[model samples]
Target chain A: MNLSELLDNRDGQVYRLLFYDCRPLLQHILANYNINDSQREYDCIMDFYLYLRGDEEPFAMLTAIKSEKALPSWLKTVFSRFMARRANHDGQTDYSDSAFDKIPDDEEDSRIFTISDLNTAITLIEQINTSYSAPERVIFFADIDALASNRHSTDEIISVLHCTEGNLRVMRHRLKKRVQQTLAKLTTND
Target chain B: MTDTLIYKYAYNQCTPDERRAVRDMLVSDFSECFAVVGLMKTRAVNDIESSMLKAPALALAVSPKERRKTLEKGRRGLPDVDACKNAPAPKALPDIAYDEEMAEMSEPIMIKEQAFGMSMYFDEMPLQPAPDFLGILNRYLQSE
Candidate 1:
């Protein structure tokens, strides 16, 4: 039988498929929002399952889905609407366009490091510091500072660090990429 | 997955429809959102670093440690760090080409095999028992 038929039959395998598939969605909601309670998280996932099992509209919507690939995004929309509605019922979410603006978009990218992303990067550096020797870590952090300080010329960095210009550029670039890779790993580690 | 649309979205260079598509995904696409944020952060830093690379170095006013602290401090957030530690594992983001034909198209899967623990991103808070639907479902299966 097709996935839709298996879903319609409420097959155990289908349940497993969806459970694993949507687990990340559940994780995302719990991670990003202020909801920290495990019970609440359980209820949220259970509610989504019930919504999908609903014989009226949700089940119909599930069957209507053409591509299995769209299932994740479609489920996300359902969750978004679910959260929005729940927030409205609880008198918490502001429906105005301004509210989304306040939802906090990419503050770290805006050069504001007083937030967690930067701290994660730092903690990540310490965690992976073993990969690099002691001198490498010190020099990398220092050179990034020098370049970022707006006071150091490339020549000055090379001279002060007692390294060739190419070495300075290559080492700094490699270290920066490592930091980015670590952050990416954190996000993609499922 | 590295899609031009996601790149455009990161840069705020996409059209309204494309932006809407990406915005919708951001709600559930935690990994994608993180990747996009990383991309933007890199771009922002590169812009500044590139400019600084060419400019001549002046008098050494700030010590390297102090200067590094300032830059790192600018990026670090204790709360966000805590949040990262408490965060669960993230799945791959779908590479959906957002356009007029997007609705009809099936996204190609591009899952990365990277070693990362779900609990590594969140804070020092003790992990609570995560809800598992399969456990309940398994009970029903046995009963059946």
Candidate 2:
């Protein structure tokens, strides 16, 4: 849907929800990415809001909004694709056939995080921690931190990190796998 | 679980079962849960000493100009600092409690009284009572 159309249809609920819920989710994402400066994060959030609403040119706006000199290539690509899809829906111009037709077959299998998806994961993690043993809780925390840090190597993760090898291996084999599966399920639903 | 237990759990100081019970209570009765949370938050803020609770932006609410004027006026209108410092502290409110509804309704009447007092500053003359012209006529009628 067009930005205006979405706003009109949702009657400000979208903006309210974005500020109330999605802003905190974005903050969490930024924290995971090690972007801790509050002002920079605030600007990035405002930039994202303006970009989504079609108020500014996409790439130029992103450059002005982000404090970093260059964003990760993967992030830039994802953002561009998101913008292109939004532009197309907004009826500004159609994406090239090449752009429209190229779907990543891997996306069907890969996990992506959405705001609600992350909230549910957090809730489940809390529940598990409440019900689990102390060692199990430590394992859960390690796995969650590992996931947030984007470090997927189980063996390297075990040795370099402080937790016992057995616990780390169990966490990697079982807990991490469960988290990934949960994330995949959420992505599919989204 | 009780509200006190829920408040403790909210602060992450409760046992696992207590935490679970608190969470279950919150999930079922969210409004009451949030009220407990709100009270905890208020107490937390209050526990921080005033000097330690400074936020620079919030200080702008009382402008420097207004602050200076207030100080100057206090100097001129009020008693000397040493005398005021030596004076006994004001008495606390008497140890009496009223119904909640009466307390709530009392505020507006107090506010009206304050407003009436403020109006005297704008008006120079003191308020006078209305003349009673009918008193003489009533006296004459009674004599007849």
Candidate 3:
């Protein structure tokens, strides 16, 4: 089914596949890792998707993902597995279901990242980041590292995140709202 | 998400009731969750770089001398009348005798006479009065 149709009938298997197969795990990974920064995580997620789609060079995707520095341990593990799988297949089966299936379902509960979930999150992140401002993008990036590094405090985050006090406040408020809107859109479809 | 709700939430401009509604939506909706995640990512990245990436210096470079030459050529190529017209008008009073002579003369003779008279007047006077005659002369010149 088309993307719109998939979104509209939220009960459909495809939507279920998208959610159960992707969203829930992605959310768990982000929350578990405390990846509070949306932008960098979003980029990492997009790079992961592009890597899955065979639309990006593996080395480039790896480099970009590495730069984010906030990738959850599970995500890194899944990525290594994905890389191994890709190598074994010689890039010929980049989009194959088998590749995604290799990620064990039980491992998901272990907070082990699934390639499928990362790919899906990457896709969603790419779609939303295109509409965000520069400052918003930075905060999102810093949030990933901050969460990963266990650093918390609006002032400290604002300093490391490189935004003014007022701007940080505004960005924090606006970003949270936009995230909610994007989530609604993703699920609503029509 | 509701636009009003999103706007309110974004600005922290929301009431407690609105904030609670936003929190509820964020918690219940997967789409909202992902969006929040994405937005947060964007904000994080924005911290380091916000300006559009610049093209390489070689691509943007234009030598100062080259720019100056271009500007000079542009100035030279402009119409003479436009250049002359834009000069601040001289603050001196009108040459009364010249004005009286022109007023007495017929239009056609005045035109011909003034053609030579302008050069003579300009040469003779250290400071020329704002050239009120120039406007009429320019119109006549254009018709020719």
Candidate 4:
């Protein structure tokens, strides 16, 4: 139905289309997960529509999936997360290991490590890691950003960083610990 | 998956067997991942919407006079439509005439015309005698 033409709008029609189109998908997903709340489903749909109103690329992307006629993969996660936040309305997210086990596959979570957050984390590392050498910091951030793109293989990373398996493992260990601390601070402060 | 394990998974650090197991678990338990998505959308709202909304108010606040001045300035540079549509026609050309003396020399003639300038130049250059032509012509008559 020429979704781009419809969605590349700062108009009422775009909102109407998104409401009619995404409502059922949001309902189906929530229903599948047994949340069963029409209000929450409507809330998710409204959130998506409002989100779409402010930007074009996301709408362009969502529209491009017209043939699929399903909730775009990312939005499914987004809607689910919306419900989860409603569930966690009290305060700070629980930071226990149980929390990790609870939501492992959510690539776009509260601690999802955004680019700005990553930049802040990098700056924090620079300020904090007085002992880490210049080359080490360079390799560490470079490797982390590449990993974040989620496109590289382990062998590719090892070769690019010019490190052996044992050395790379140690580097990853150090990076994981540092990133966890930095992102924790960044998320809580936000 | 442990938080460390999830971090490793995000970075492609987990081995294949570990990766498979973790993915299976996450898929089997998909609903909890919603909170993470919720946080992401919250961060994105801050990331984009605020900046986008700021630009429009600044755009609209430009004084009407300033906008009019800019519009007039842009119009000033455009070519005049009347001037383009009524471009004058080319001036008429003088007629061609054969020169009797030049024709007597039996030389090759040259003609040049400049259309817009409405000018033409004519001259005749000496044509070199060629053995082949003379031989062909010889059969029709006596050689000079």
Best candidate (score: lDDT): 1
Question: In model 3 chain A, which range of ten residues has the least summed lDDT?
Answer: A6-15
10 residues in a row with least lDDT, candidate 3 chain B: B51-60
lDDT of 1 at A129: 30
What TM-score does each of the candidates earn?
A: 0.26, 0.20, 0.23, 0.21
lDDT (Cα, tens digit) per residue for candidate 1, span A22-44: 44444454334445444344445
Highest-DockQ candidate: 3
User: Which digits, one per residue and each the tens of the lDDT, describe model 4 over residues B1-144?
Assistant: 243333333322445565555455444443212222222222222222121111122212223454354445442232232343344422322211111112233233232223312121111211222232223212211210
* lDDT values, one for every candidate: 0.39, 0.35, 0.36, 0.36
User: Which parts of model 2 are misplaced by more than 4 Å?
Assistant: A1-122, A130-134, A142-170, A183-190, B1-144
Q: Which stretches of candidate 4 lie over 4 Å from their true place?
A: A1-5, A8-11, A32-34, A63-190, B1-144
**Which DockQ-derived CAPRI band holds candidate 3?**
incorrect
* Model 2 lDDT tens row, B1-144: 264454344233455566567666555543332233233332222211111111212212323453355445432221133332344432332111111112223222112434324233213322221111122112211220
Question: Which stretch of 10 consecutive residues in model 4 chain B shows the poorest summed lDDT?
Answer: B116-125
Q: What TM value does chain B of candidate 3 have?
A: 0.27
Per-residue lDDT tens digits for candidate 3, residues B13-131, read 44557556766664444334333442344333332222111211111222345435444544222122223334443233222111111212312111243432334432332321113
In angstroms, the error of model 3 at A69 is: 38
Measured as a fraction from 0 to 1, the native contacts recovered by model 4 come to 0.00
- The all-Cα superposition gives candidate 4 an RMSD in Å to the true structure of 34.9
